[model samples]
Target: MAHILLADDDKATRDLVKRALESDGHKVDLTQDGAEALDRLIAAPEGIDVLVSDVHMPGLDGIDLARRAIETSPRLKLLLMSGFAEELDRAQALKSPNLNVIIKPFTLEQIRSAVRTLIA
Candidate 1:
């Protein structure tokens, strides 16, 4: 099982995602704001293997969070979800081949599949 950091502003989304991941035997840490998420990532204890985040959020956004997280942990894997996926930078979008950007309204299976792909 992998340890995941989930950052999204919507409470429902956060809860649902957390439950889904936990059901799969993964440990999930949640935060509603991007800035807080970044801080947590910076100070996170060991075993945090991946980050799943919404694109738009108060304070820092997901792209900034991903960039900073990568800086903090070069081995960290990222999955960025968004309602408006086009708003992110084109270069960054295409930069990391391992990055997964799931659009909003994704199924639990999709999230699980993405996580499994990264973990595998």
Candidate 2:
């Protein structure tokens, strides 16, 4: 199983995603914001296999966090989520090989599939 670092400002969304990923047999480290996620990634760069983050947050956003994380962990897989169309557009423009953007209101199965594809 892969180690996933999940970041989302919404508590309900974060919890739901965590449970879905965990049910798929992955170990997840949950964070409420991008700053905290970045700190965790920096603390143990090699420990995380994938980063699933929300696009919008109070501090650093998912796109910025993913960019920074890649600087430290080049191979880190990214799955960015956002309900905002503009945010999704920004994520798509990143054009990174290991990065993917998922729109919000997705089913648990969809997220599980995305995570599986990322780690595969």
Candidate 3:
């Protein structure tokens, strides 16, 4: 199983994702925002195998977080999520080979599959 760092500002969304991923046998670390996620990544660069973050977090949006995380851990796999088309477009424009975006309102299976595929 992969170790995943899951970040989202919404408590409900974050909890749902964490439970879903954990049920799928992945070890998930939950964070309320990108800033905390970044701190965790910095503190233990080798600890996480994947980052699944919401695109519009308060402190450090997912795109910026991914950029910074990649700087510290270049091989880090990213799965960014958002409901906004603009944010999704921004993620797409990043042109990161290791990055993937998931539109919100997605099912648990969809997210589980995405994480599995990204880490695979």
Candidate 4:
């Protein structure tokens, strides 16, 4: 199972994602914002395999988080989620390999599949 770092301000979304990933037997670490997420990533002695974040957050939005995270861990797989078209567009503009985006209002199955594919 992969160690996953998930960052999202919305509690429901965070919990939902955590639950979905956990069901797949992945060990998921949750963060409310990108800053905390970055901190966790840096502090992690055992590296994280995947990062799933919300594009819109209180501080250190997903795009910037993705940029920094990728720099810090180049092999890190990333998935940015957003309901806003503009935010998704912003994520699309980032120049990072192994980066993927998903629109919000997705099913648990979809998210699970996305992560499965991401780590595959």
Per-residue accuracy of model 2 over 42-113 as CA lDDT, tens digit each: 999999999999999988999999889889899999999998999888888877899988898999999999
What tens-digit string does per-residue lDDT give for candidate 3 at 1-120? 999999999999999999999998899999999999999999999999999999998879998998898898988899999999999998888788889999999999999999888877
- Tell me which residue pairs clash in candidate 1: none
Comparing candidate 1 with candidate 4, which one achieves the higher TM-score? 4
RMSD of 2: 0.7
Off by over 4 Å in 1: 88-94
Candidate 3 overall Cα lDDT vs. reference?
Answer: 0.92
How much is the lDDT of residue 65 in candidate 2? 94
Which regions in candidate 2 have their CA more than 4 angstroms from the true location? Answer: none
Q: Candidate 4, residues 1-120: lDDT per residue as tens digits?
A: 889999999999999999999999999999999999999988873489999999999879999999888888888999999999899888878767788888989999999999998989
Residue 91 of model 4, lDDT score: 84
TM-score of every candidate relative to the true structure: 0.90, 0.97, 0.96, 0.95
| Steric collisions counted per model | 0, 0, 0, 0
Clashes of 4: 0
On TM-score, the stronger of 1 and 2 is 2
The TM-score of predicted model 2 comes to 0.97
lDDT of 3 at 84: 97
